[model samples]
Target: MDQDDSETCQMCPMDEWPNREKTRCLPKLQEFLSYKEDKMASFFCFLVILCCVITCFTLKKFILYWDTPLVKANNRTLSFTVLVSLLLSFLCVFFFLGRPLDITCMLRQTLFGIFFSLAISSLIAKSMMVCIAFKATKPSSSWKKWTGVTLPYSIVVVCSSVQVLICVSWLSTYPPYQGFDMTTYPGKIIIQCNEGSDIWFYSMLGYLGFLAAVSFVLAFMVRTLPDSYNEAKYITFSMLVFCSVWIAMIPAYLSTRGKYMVAVEIFAILTSCAGILSCIFLPKLYILLIKPYLNTRKHVFSWVRK
Candidate 1:
């Protein structure tokens, strides 16, 4: 009932919510992922910075050893491509940490998707190169044509271009935007990005998953080859970890609401990126830094002969 007339009732303004007693309206609370208040967001920010620094360091080391037999053993171009993509993937988490905005909402997922696809495509190219190199060792083999740089470079470009096209299509059509959720929690306005189209969002993820699956299968096929020229085992392990994290993330992301939902995604992105970084690069780093003697061409050929 209204204060002036017992028969009349009044509604609160958009900025105000009803009190528990329904006697008067109070201001609505704003909710979002805040760096100051959200411990998880702050922690994730720290991790992102840490990962970026590590990637830069690794890239520097690879650059210094650019002419070394070890670096040349793997396709230097593809390795650099993977490292750069992984660095960008780590940085992409920032857009999901701050308050939802029109631009951030639109860019966050698409950027992450594109960067991850690039990394996966590079790994697939690496695996293919290893297989072709092994086959080209045979006398008068047809795989000799693919042993050159052209084939792997073409693979990376073609594979990554498909993902770029998907993201462009998604953004041009139904795109994500900032939205408010008032009904989820009383007396609070939960500000979040409303993914404009679930179909497009899932399609983006599905395409990424498809690329990962292809990479994983290709890597697995070449996993039994000698370690000197074969990075397929590492690629297979990384893709396994990457696929598992996102597969689990889908359900958790669907069930959570508000800030927690964002946290789940950030966690998935960081963990999967870390998986790729550590799995593919760590062993190579170990040899480059710790076992320098093993990086020699003689040792590599010895392993190849055995």
Candidate 2:
């Protein structure tokens, strides 16, 4: 075709242009409407509160039984074990969510990866703490004193830091998640930190799997410990619940049907709530409230003392 025809093609009538921007400039990245942001923020905020309530109640019970002869008599090393979940819940509430879209995928992924790493590492550290407690009871020897403040925490810091660097590097090198020249939703171009590449997506899966692995080991170690069968059963059940997340999360991330995907995310968060409550909160409640009799010395393991 001649140059005039080509130029005319570009000047095709306004109605003929697919979108106004196709005639002129690059399409703008979509921003979530402030209302949409607020709505999502509010919903997640409520979820945070719900998690906090469950965590705080459990911690309260742990505090109550912490100094009792029953808790100490078990030779538990620390004055508090359940307190960490309470603290993590508070951290999650205060720090996570309502994040700005990072233009630099490097910074964005770094921040996300760091938080993800810390959260999982904290959970794994918890499992290690449980195992150490079990090990302390062995008749053999000096491993008891080995269980203390610094070592497990240090391990967590190291693992989390390593993975944070891994994720940051991946993001720095990839094209930002919006992708190269793809048509996006015009009115609703929401700024989400996408998984930079297949590597990041699968890495997240691997990371969750790793956390589940450690959790399972702890669950196994505690499986046969000489505690009330109910306590043992609850912990095992909770661990199983937690592990199921890794299995479920793959499909959640892969889902691309917009709001359907959001529903999946919501379900995932709800799963977290259930796991935390079942594993950390409700068990403490059973000891402190529902079965307060269990806390009493010389009490028979019966439904009623009648």
Q: Model 2, 71-172: lDDT tens per residue?
A: 543223322433443345344432224433445433533443455456556555655665675566568757788677676677677767777666766666
**Candidate-wise lDDT, in order:** 0.91, 0.52
Expressed as tens digits, the lDDT of each residue in 1-306 for candidate 1 is: 226435666888776797767777888998888999888889999999999999999999999999898888889989999999999999999999879999999999999989999999999899889888889888999989889899898999999999898889889999999999988887888999998989888988998899899999999999998877778999999999989999999999999999999999999999999999999989989999999999999866565577
Model 1 Cα shift for residue 87 (angstroms): 0.4
Against the true structure, what is each candidate's TM-score? 0.96, 0.63
Weakest 10 consecutive residues of candidate 2 by summed lDDT: 73-82
Report how far residue 10 has shifted in candidate 1, in Å.
1.6
> What are the runs in model 2 whose C-alpha is more than 4 Å off?
1-42, 60-66, 69-100, 103-142, 145-151, 167-190, 229-233, 257-263, 296-306
Candidate achieving the largest TM-score:
1
Clashes of each: 0, 1
